[model samples]
Target: MGNRQSVVREAARFAEWVLREVGRELRVARLIAGMTQGQVAGVLGTSISHVSRVEHGLIKGAGLVALSRHAAVVGLKPWIKLYPIVGRPLDRAQLALFAKFRDRIAGTWRVTLEAPMPIPGDLRAADALLAMPGCQCMVEIITRLADFQAQVRMAHRKQRDIGASRLILVVAGNDTNRRAVRDAGAAVRDAFPLDTRATLAALTSGVDPGADGLVLL
Candidate 1:
């Protein structure tokens, strides 16, 4: 309940910030176009006070149609862009890459796809879990690696929570991911000591790589 409330509060704050920014831009455009609040309101068939409130971002329920009308009156264009939400559902490419990794490791070890975390009520799950005679490995597969540090921290947290003996980060062997790993350099090395070759060798041989590994699929 607390977590949900916190998320709602954060979202409200972000929406307020965006509204203020948009209002500021509209105010500037109106000024540059030599239009008064009254003039804009007249064109939009609304009152000057309503226009003032909208421009000041004081009207929390200002609709897009009203905003667009105001922008049109001020010789400005209103547009919105959508971005992928953090931890969004996997796309086709990502799912395919996961399948490839699963096939590679399934031959040698017991592989569980989308294995739940050990902690009760924790919705998060490891992308894959690999088990051998004396080892349990938690795996995170990335089709396109972004925010390297955040990914590392998440992997570590999952490993600790699940009490896995080993952790492996499997990424698609594309040039983009390769470059990302290269740019990360020492940080990547420090987190996952085993490189592609060594990691694969250990996985195939059912041996604990002795440390966390970064494997390219």
Candidate 2:
């Protein structure tokens, strides 16, 4: 009973912390824009009481999407980042692969980890970001092709804001993943052209891949 009580306390604290942080950001934005609570409420199509409740953290279960709409009216863009609390083992392996990729390509392009993306709940983290003389590329390291379509769609949305000249997916050389990609058919192929040889050559020759594609590294 004591342990359960402690866990409940911890959860409540976390919730309060999140609410405070979000409320603070909203307050700051409103102040910066020189907007009154009533004005913000008007824009949001809500009553002044509702806006006050939100600012005071009295509102419960208000999603980021609703907040974002309110923010947009006040010249603010609210972005919330959502990620797994504990990464899977496959994710750890991908990080190692990302390191290898960086080591091999660092001479030619500047590499960064966990790049920013415009989309909410889809942080610009495709393992690594490679910026070169003329173009930038997002590199994704894949060990499995589970939910391949969703992954591609998310990457596509990320590219809209990332301004990546090329999108590269490096699949761990495995039969299962290869077959999965093959089964994805035209959708995957259209998104990522296969240029295994070009990708490998570019890493050595200090040139970017000729086009966006998949490379078995």
Best by TM-score: 2
In candidate 2, how many Å is residue 28 off?
A: 16
Report RMSD (Å) for each prediction in the order shown. 12.4, 6.9
In candidate 2 the C-alpha lDDT for residue 210 amounts to 68
Q: In candidate 2, what are the lDDT values of residues 1-217, reduced to their tens digit?
A: 8866875776566566676667777788889999999999887889998877777776777777887887686777876554421112236878877766666564767777767554542323545678878878887778777888887776666666667888888777679887887788897768777566667667657677767877765
lDDT for each candidate structure? 0.81, 0.71
Model 1, which residues run further than 4 Å from truth?
1-90
lDDT of 2 at 159: 62
For candidate 1, write residues 85-178 as lDDT tens digits.
2224457887898787766653778887777777543546787788888889998878879889988887787888878989899899999999
Evaluate model 2: give its lDDT.
0.71
